[model samples]
Target: MGQQKTKKIEKEEPIKEEVKKPAEKIEEKKPEVKPAAKPKKAKAPRVRGQKWTAAKEKIGQKDYVIEEAIELAKSTNNAKFDASVEVHINFQLAKKSKEPIRGMVKLPHGTGKKLNVAIADDKLIEEITKTKKTPFDVLLAKTEDLAKLTKIAKILGPKGLMPSEKSGTLTADPKKTLEELNKGKISYKTDQFGILHQILGKISWDDKKLVENYQTMLSV
Candidate 1:
């Protein structure tokens, strides 16, 4: 009986060893966890005018022309303006149109700079003083006087403020002219190709203001 018991105990030991081996193998095969991935940083967009290619792209994409361009200018958000500004317009008039379709508007917003106005007639000056109770920045007695006109030409010519007979702003009718002036009617001249050009105002205005001015120019 003792010998039979010894053999049975030896067989049971082998079964226990087999179970321990499987547990150790399971622990060795277990995988280690890795860290999570981080997000990448985004790049900033390029600024306008920084590159020649960007400038060309901007100009090419712009669609505003003539009065619409003026309106866009008025709508700009810039708060300050230079003493003088130059504006250009391209207009296509009907071939047979008898009346002049191009003119300038001074705008109630002013030119974003001080202006020296020269009036030809004494009566107009008197009326401006009497009714408006104000004197113009500068005045010229002879509208056609080349010498007097030449003196101020250097100052006003490049600035686009010099009065010309072609613009129709220099007229005998002070009351009518002043009425328009108060209502934002100024003057404008045309290029060699009959395209109207004038300084509307500063570039600091908002988009809506520019659009209004542009529409007014178109209507005129």
Candidate 2:
């Protein structure tokens, strides 16, 4: 009886050892965790219109004044069609301005491009909504019609076609404004980037005409 009990105890010890071996093997086979990879930064899109690269480089880095810039700009216009001359002025306004400087001026010479004008009314509002595109370059509105056109503000605002009180496009009296606009008049305002850009004249015009037009814009 003693010898049988001894044999049974020895067999139970080996069985227990066999059961623990699998658990030890599972722990040894566990996978090692690695740190996550970082995301790559996005690159800015390249600017379009490579045709003006050489022309712009030729203008050089020198700070040319109004007169010298006009001549240089005229000389550099190598487009097949006549390029329009523009007067762009940088203002010292802060990024978050309480009272932004905005003004309208009547240039002696008109913008070379013919602009389609429209008076804002119920009929015109219906006409504009009927089409996907708004056909007019300038929109004139009175006090009564101004609130009515708010529905279409999203459409016209981005195109810079939305008439505002500050720009004098939205007015109680549009007749005088129309006459002034017909006589080479335009509005100039400092943009969000603090730059005022206005169409001065065409490159085909005489340098004298450009200078005079630029001076008129400067006066405004």
Candidate 3:
């Protein structure tokens, strides 16, 4: 009986040790299982065209000539349509020199539409009237006479003929102004943000016409 009891006790002790060893191993392995790392976020792609808001913000209170402005428009792909050179001259008195600077130029290709001009002088009005079958739609003696002129501000303003000081159209030189009108000279003002917008010429215009118009604008 004593020999049997000793053998049984030894077996029981071995079984207990085996169970304890497995439990210890399970506890030790728990801390080694870490959480997986998260993936990084992707960045957005840049837009191809320039932002109008951004351009306006950058041009504030700065005086940019028609030539510089045209170059910028071409390079940035902002303003390219008809032969129109729009510029934003600085608001400073010094920047507004007494000498007349050319404000806008139009190509022979036309702006793809007829221009409606209101002449401040009766002589110019009669001269424009003789071209009754010409491409122009309207010709008047007073600026305030045409309601349509005021109505088409968006179309004409960007085309640089809103009669504002910025456009140089509100002038006393009837002959010179009429000549420019016939030649497709328009003007536009920079908004509060100082960004001036205008067309140069149609894509169909020849290199010579483009160069001539470009030179004319630069001289202004």
Best by lDDT: 2
Model 2, range 78-108, lDDT digits (tens) per residue? 7788889987878778877856567687777
Error of 2 at 55 (Å): 4.0
Q: How many backbone clashes does candidate 1 have?
A: 7
lDDT of 1 by residue, 34-58 (tens): 7877877788897554455543554
Ranking by TM-score: 2, 1, 3
In model 1, the runs with Cα more than 4 Å from the true position are 1-53, 61-87, 93-110, 121-166, 173-183
TM-scores, all models, native as reference = 0.42, 0.70, 0.32
Per-residue lDDT over 87-181 for candidate 3, one digit per residue giving the tens place of the 0 to 100 score: 23344333445543335455554443456666544444344345423223333223443443454445444543445443555554545776776
In angstroms, give how far residue 145 of model 3 lies from its true place. Answer: 9.9
Q: Enumerate clash totals for all models, in the order shown.
A: 7, 0, 8
Superposing all C-alpha atoms, what RMSD in Å does each candidate have to the true structure?
Answer: 25.4, 9.4, 19.8
Q: How far out, in Å, is residue 51 in model 3?
A: 20
